[model samples]
Target: MFVRTENFRTFTKLYPIITTITAIHLVLWLIVQFSENFLHLTVGYNLLVFQGEYWRLFTPIFLHESITHLLFNSLSLVLFGPGLERLLGKVKFISMYLLGGIAANVATLLLAPVYYSHLGASGAIFALFGIYFYMVFFRPDMLNTANSQIVLVILAISLVMTFFTGNVNIYAHLFGFLAGTIMAPIFLGKGTYTRSLSQIFPNMRRSPSTAGKGQSIFWIVLIVLVALGALSRFM
Candidate 1:
């Protein structure tokens, strides 16, 4: 489910919302790179938020502090988003994404000091993981055994990294995940199980032996990318 086989045009056609949001990520990051004022205005600054600049909560969902930050979160959204988008439909999917992000920002506002500020879509990305986590236990029919294992392993690694890594927004990741977990039942009630990835690329189905290899490769590549992203922060 994590593998992407779609070409750019097909992918955009299939998952317009994901494509558009990723485009927004890129565009906003470029704008922020050149314009310090825009970055300050949109970043999730607790002081400004507490003083009634309410939009920070929402705007920060689309902003990132660096190119590496943008690429990591956007790559995550691209990899994991389409399945849920297909399952939940456009409206509910976007709703869950936004709610997860906004919830994280709100948590940051309440818990962090006045000087604290953050920018990225990690909160929303973790929210997607939260939904997958809920599926692994409660809605097993929605994901195959391989996908379930992938979700659990990746989530475990991510949570560990969240605490260990520097310059990370712990509040956003934790609360966004919580919000998605709580919201999953509401969004997924009585929905029929559908493997959107297989439907999109039926020809890519693999035998059990090859499937295991594919999963192993996926884990390796994803871990390398995540490690690079973490290391980039220090560099």
Candidate 2:
């Protein structure tokens, strides 16, 4: 006779923040595959963006134009997100992801040709890569292990792909990397979490507010979107 016991230990190591975010992206893509209307609503349309559907700034990061796009970005997020989350903690990590994607979308909408639609989470993944890139330089300990070497190789391949690929949003990737680098000093700072946030935006220090660092990100994102949307009109 033989007996087998189920194993749940592996699941214990999974990062909930990364898993949940990935699930949402995959689920949204599934819906778009089945529903054309959703596909239309999700893509970053410049006209609709300026028309006050400011959500397009953030949502486009969740929308993938093709299955290949979804798979590549989803895989990158799943692989890179957990390590970053552990490094920065969940709240700040998610903020970086959102800010990266939003910044990339803003750059694309404003700088790319008008009527040029953009979508996909490569921007967010690039943000993660940006943080990793910073680590490779400033935080040498982060790349002390063997895993980091693999990540560096992966990033190099991605950079090459971004330049050669036709439909890719190169601008989004570039801006996302920049955004991540900008936020890294805060997320990976030496001080306490609150102090780190204050470094990111000095204004946060002025208010006697109860809002956490992550909550402040929403307001920052909103203000940036509104300001950029208005600026897009003039440009």
Candidate 3:
């Protein structure tokens, strides 16, 4: 499958932004061999989701089971990521990718049966799908050049494929998609990226202005916790 550049020019214009992030993740993936090996699904695999090894939730998105898995996922980055990056800008776009990925993996560890180990960019990709759905459904006017038809079509197919695909952790994808959908109103709102939470909340009636601040804090704490936990796992 391919998303044409002409149809998604807004996404194309910011291709380099997401490419840089993908490159950084590629490098990070190489640094941790264990991260590469652990983020997989099998008949039986044990993880420290609650006990620790929290980074396992994130590391798998950085690795690929095979070249084909990497190819399709990177293609998705080329296809959809640019548009999202354009919408969310360099910062939040990256945050969505990383956070969505982490959330999916962590949820798998916390919720899914231990007999299965989950991995892939599917959760993050679904995050994009869910977020776009929110924009088209709730804040269509704010989107620069969004196509409602395209959004609906993409979501419909994604859901159908989710049910049919055997290797994928559909549960994780659903959780990430739900998370992204709920969070979109905050990111899509006025001054989401440029302004602080305090500033946005006062003007905002529906969402707390501190929404942005809360997201920032969440990212910071998540990063620190993952970092410290991963370091201990390595030690």
TM-score list, all predictions: 0.89, 0.73, 0.66
Q: What tens digits encode model 1's per-residue C-alpha lDDT throughout 1-235?
A: 7877789999999899999999999999899989999998899999998899999999999998776787778888988899999888899999999999999999999999999999899899889898987887667688776787678778888898899888899999999999999999888864455444343234545665666666666777787768757874775
Most TM-score-accurate candidate:
1
Candidate 1: which stretches are off by over 4 Å? Answer: 190-213
Against the hidden true structure, what lDDT does model 2 obtain?
0.70
Off by over 4 Å in 2: 1-13, 190-235
lDDT of 2 by residue, 1-235 (tens): 0011213344225466777777888899889889989878878988788888888898888886565566666656755676777777778888999999999999998888878888888788888888876775566555542344444555666676678656778899899988887888778863222222222233424454665555455345434433432332233
Candidate that would win on lDDT:
1
For model 3 the TM-score comes to 0.66
Colliding pairs, model 3: 11-83, 197-209, 201-209
**Residue lDDT tens for model 3, 11-78:** 44546676665674566445444563333421113355554556566666666554445555565565
Model 1 lDDT at residue 69: 81
Candidate 3 residue runs with Cα over 4 Å from true position: 1-13, 24-46, 143-146, 190-235
Of candidate 1, the 10-residue stretch with the lowest lDDT total is: 194-203
> CA shift at 19, candidate 1, in angstroms?
0.3
Each prediction's total of clashing residue pairs, residues at least 3 apart in sequence or on different chains, is 0, 0, 3
